[model samples]
Target: MLLDTFGRQAVDLRVSLTDRCDLRCTYCMPEQGMTWLAKPTLLTDEEVVRLVRIAVTLLGVREVRFTGGEPLLRPGLVGILTACARLQPRPELSLTTNGIGLARTAAALRGAGLDRVNVSLDTLDPRTFQRLSRRDRHHDVLAGLTAARAAGLSPIKVNTVLMRGINDHEAPDLLAWCLERGYELRFIEQMPLDPQHGWDRSTMVTAAEILDRLSTRFTVTPEPAGRRGSAPAERWIVDGGPARVGVIASVTQPFCRACDRTRLTADGQVRNCLFATGETDLRTALREGGDDPRTDARIAELWRAAMWGKKAGGGIGDPDFHQPERPMSAIGG
Candidate 1:
């Protein structure tokens, strides 16, 4: 197991397939002046599958979530998923995307062994979506979600970020829309991962405020506190029954103590924490060719060290807290 000094085991692995995105969401990155990773710097599809294999077959990882600026943009994605699905102790596979190309790729992805997906869809309004995402693909995202459902991706999750002045008022409406469509909705508190670094704590919406907004139209009740494990989202029963909603309050309610996630960037760095300022390089060791056992052992060793050195928390509450140099886009979701 990838055990840390704090007695936490990293069982969930978030793999970044690429740092390129189709939509330039204002909260994620600037629309212009973005410098993307060089193609050569990224891990090959085979390298990704191998690393994931090591994590699963060797390092005790059970869930593999492929994230990116948009993972759907990766050309070799289907092949990578196919390979990972064939691992000895096959891990539960999922993807986090902006839902741009899912209309074309959802069926292939589900057929290739993707179990589910968490797509980012902030607003139900097209104009609000364009203003927030800096793109006119609002309908495209909705269409993609429909495609994902038809493709049999179970419990297709919709991740929404409610900005203060932007689309905060649409919480109730978003929940109603999601409930009607049977799409699980999760509202996330905006973190300090944007490249522009314009995050303001006062102006940002909190989990309490989100629930308050939703309560206007839905009788939302918290699930038992003990029910939430390492999952980032704190789920709430909606409308008194099986229907539910989640709030990922990364800033206001940090779940770092129960964080089971280990992030692998598109370029092959091990990130113990999302707000970490440092990274352990696994790419160089991966490229140093050797037998599969030897390479896998080395990868496992480095991963263990990275987790062992993980900080107690994401550090957003500290007086000296500073945002990570790489934006969320480069670092993956």
Candidate 2:
């Protein structure tokens, strides 16, 4: 296992298949759209599979998640997932999607050995959904969720980004809906990952506050996990059916203390920190075909540097610190 400075072992890798997305969320992708990485910089399907192989064989990467500006946009996504599933001692493979194109692809992805899905859906109301997602596919997204369930994707996770005045009031309602549907509803604390979206901490809502609100309706209690890494979502069991709820406190509470995640950008750059200022380009090593020893040495050196740069806690203090990169979508959150 690749352990960091804080002794957090790297077990999961969130890989971005593409830097392109369909909808432009208010808090994520830029309003006027942002510049994307060049196609040549992006990792090919074979290169991505190679990286995953190395990560699992060498770095103890046991869980692989395909994310993106929207992973569904990648044409070869299903093929990549199939390859991961067929790996020796295959890791748990999953994908995070906006659910725009999920209806058509859910069954195909599940057939490809995708364990499950996490769909980004902040608002249940159609108008609010369109306002937040900048798309009029609320019904389609919901249909995607239904398709996921129909495809037998067990324990489907619906991610809700709680922005104050935007979807905060709908927390209880969303909780009720998830409980009824047997879906896991996860509330994510908005971070300033992309400052271009005009993120202000003042508008941020704390996990504690969300819990306090949720507790008014259900008996909230912690759910157990073998190991909780840097994902930041403190899970809980909720009322009605077997539905669960999780709150990812990245802003008010950072999980960097136990963060074991490494992000691979669509352009083949391995990012040590989600909010990291520096990224190691892995494409160069992949292209230099002749020297295996040199390639391995370079990748290892980059990994060591990234692990060395990991902090005891990220976003613990620096209230005024603005992340230079775009938010989760652009960075494959």
Candidate 3:
């Protein structure tokens, strides 16, 4: 296991397959999306697989999650996933997507050894979805979710970012909808990752406020502490039953102390934290490869050095916290 200076073990790696996405969510990017990385600058399928192999074999990473502007947008995504699954002592493979294209590719992805998925769906109302995403494909997202379930992707996670005066009022209703369909709903606190830099702490909804709203309708009880180890979402048993909901309080309540995640951008830069201002470039080392052993050693060294400097917490709540250069899509949400 790779242990940082703070004794935090890096067990999970989030890989961004592409910096391209279909939707332009208000919280993720500007109405007009920012410039995307050139295709030549993006890592090739072989390069991505090589890094994952080193991560699993040398760094002891046990979980690999593919994130993107939308991972489904990557043409060779299924092939990349299949390659990762063939690793010795294979890691748990998962993907985070907007779900617009999942309807067409869910079964193929599952067959390629993808273990499960987390789909981003902010609002159940079609009009509201369009207003937030700047796209009229809300129904496409719903269809994608249905297709994912039919493809045997168990425990589908629905990621909802709660923005006050917007979709915050639909908390209970959203949870009810997911519960009825056996989907695990996770309410994420809006972070300062938007490209427009319009995140306001004053207007952002808190996890406690979310629970209070759910309590008005359902018995929202916190699951026993320590049950969520290094996982961002805090689980809760709803209405004293098997149905559950989760809240990722990244802003109001930071989980950096227990954060065991590291991210690899589509261009092959290693990021120790979501809010990190710097990254370690592994793409250069891979492309300049002559000695495989030396390159592998350098990869391991870079990973350890990056994690060694992880901040104790994400300082978004600080008075002078500045947002990172890349938006959520490019950075791998």
Cand. 1 Cα-lDDT = 0.93
Would you estimate the TM-scores of all the predictions? 0.98, 0.92, 0.98
Lowest summed lDDT across 10 adjacent residues in model 2 is found at: 313-322
Please provide the root mean square deviation of candidate 2 (C-alpha atoms, Å). 2.3
lDDT of each: 0.93, 0.82, 0.90
Residue range 1-333, candidate 1, lDDT tens digits: 998899999999999999889898888889899999998899999889989998998899999999998998899999999999999898999999999899999999999999999999999999999999899999999999999999999889999999888999999999989989999999999899998988788978999999999989889999977999999999999978899899999999899999999999999999999999999999989999556568788888999999999999998979999999999999987
Q: Compared to the true structure, candidate 1 yields what TM-score?
A: 0.98
| Angstrom error at residue 317, model 3 | 1.9
Per-residue C-alpha lDDT of model 2 across residues 293-322, encoded as one tens digit per residue: 667656666766676667566553485554
- Angstrom error of the Cα, residue 36, model 3: value is 0.7
lDDT of 3 by residue, 204-286 (tens): 89999999989889998889988898889999999897888999999888988888998999999999889988889989888
**TM-score: which is higher, 1 or 2?**
1
Error of 1 at 86 (Å): 0.6
Off by over 4 Å in 3: none
Candidate 2: which pairs clash? none
| Alpha carbon lDDT at 178, candidate 3 | 96
